[model samples]
Target: DDMTDPVADSARSLLDGHVVLSRKLAELGHYPAVDPLASVSRLMNSVVSKEHLLASQRFKAIYATYQGAEDMINIGALAPGANRRIDRAVSLIDRVNEFLLQPIGQRCEFQQTVKWLLDITKSWDFLLPAEQDLPPEVPAGPNEADA
Candidate 1:
């Protein structure tokens, strides 16, 4: 909402804020875990282009769907698509859990974010790959890449 405030620490204050990631990422030890629900941008409609806005909206919809599935898990219910959608959501979440949340003071590059977004936003036409396709922990970052 206040993207112009250079002093603000929250994402809404950033130039192109969209969805806040999740604090759960931090509890799980992901650095800079942003709350997707908290990361909404108030300026998208007015300041951004139609294509970008639509792309962002699509991304958010997937996150929301995944979030809904998470809620269903709590109530012991599954969404209509069953393991198919869940697998995709898992891959999406795993990528977030593995690659998206950068370390303290580090930032995700544009292409990285784009690739991640595209990979997850894909419509499921086939059964999602086995959970084995998802990483159990954070994927190696730039820091880990050298070591």
Candidate 2:
């Protein structure tokens, strides 16, 4: 595996981003009197929405990389329709932006949706095979063993 792979790097960066944005949004909940619309709009512009676009591209890259070959296909075998999880996470983020644009009193679970953004990060971890899932070592052939 290439240690400096850009796709993996981007995924890590996006995961870190979700952590920051979720913390900011969660902090707003502490100040009950503060209006969330402005803070959310700023977050959307600054990080959340930008990440949302990158995520779509990342999803395609990931699927193309993993959707074929037995070894590369472990992601699908492990998560089964895992690509949809990314789409769902993106949709949740979109709902947050849509909610922010609406007038007050329009019901939406802003906090819950923000929290769920972490799921996008969590879902990627599932793609990694656990130690138990690793294939067993093959026995060496007689000629190779003599060497």
Candidate 3:
């Protein structure tokens, strides 16, 4: 009973923090409005939720794989397939910061912190190799097909 108690408590805490943070982020503005803090806050909640689910082993193997992918993104671990997702997430956050936070109008200090967090995430050493230079697969010749 004691063993499960801590897990349950931790899960509860993460969930509570996620919910509170989500609500606070939502109160700032509407979606697609390019609010960096709001976007980063939402992403952070998603990362925490996925991590909690992975830790609890509550999902199917496929779901766990997806969670692992998200974890790589959240933690900025480099791997072959995970880079695109991580890059996309970082790019979105970056755009939000550039468009919304960098301007003089309607500034928020929280937005600056979010940008810093994003920079740290993007700078992680686990980044995957660039995909642009991958060697193209040659078509199998007619004789090669028989082998």
Candidate 4:
């Protein structure tokens, strides 16, 4: 989530970095640039609930799988043996791509983010647009913006 912050954050700020999303989302091309590898969150065990934490882990795993599949595809090695996995990976990547279809200034709530993430993990086939896929919008909730 940090776009290379220079400020010497306090211990609270350091640990509060429960969610470090990859600003390199290809889905954000409605603007420019993205970095997919640097994304994962779950540091605030003291504040966030357990269920959501677990969901976050699942979300991380999915992103990891997508990255792996992308690597394979780039190398032209995603062939017969890893066929299904490759399909799932590309599908997951596309799903995340679909997620970037949001309007400007609007933010997804923590519950809504978790909901989309859970839905993302449960089924690779189900693709939702940013508007319909997301839960109801809320005030500035527990979330960080990406590129």
Best by lDDT: 1
| Cα lDDT listed for each candidate | 0.60, 0.41, 0.41, 0.55
Residue-level lDDT of model 2, residues 1-147, one tens digit each, is: 332589856765555232212344345552223223212222444655555544433443333333233253434443433444333333344343343343446555755654444344334333444543344568999899989
RMSD of each: 16.1, 15.3, 13.9, 17.5
lDDT of 1 by residue, 1-147 (tens): 354565555534555656555556767886667766557667668975674566566666556657867877668786444555565665566554454467667777776676666565555333335664344666789998999
lDDT of 3: 0.41
Cand. 4 TM to true fold: 0.53
Off by over 4 Å in 4: 1-15, 18-42, 80-86, 123-147
* Order of the predicted models by TM-score, top scorer first: 4, 1, 2, 3
Q: What is the lDDT of residue 55 in candidate 1?
A: 55
User: Which one wins on TM-score?
Assistant: 4
lDDT of 4 by residue, 41-114 (tens): 33556677776666555555566666766776788876534444445656676676555456668777867876
Off by over 4 Å in 3: 1-101, 115-126, 130-136, 144-147
Candidates 1 and 4, the one with greater TM-score:
4
The parts of candidate 1 lying over 4 Å away from their true place are 1-23, 46-49, 74-87, 105-107, 124-147
Select the stronger candidate by TM-score from 2 and 3: 2
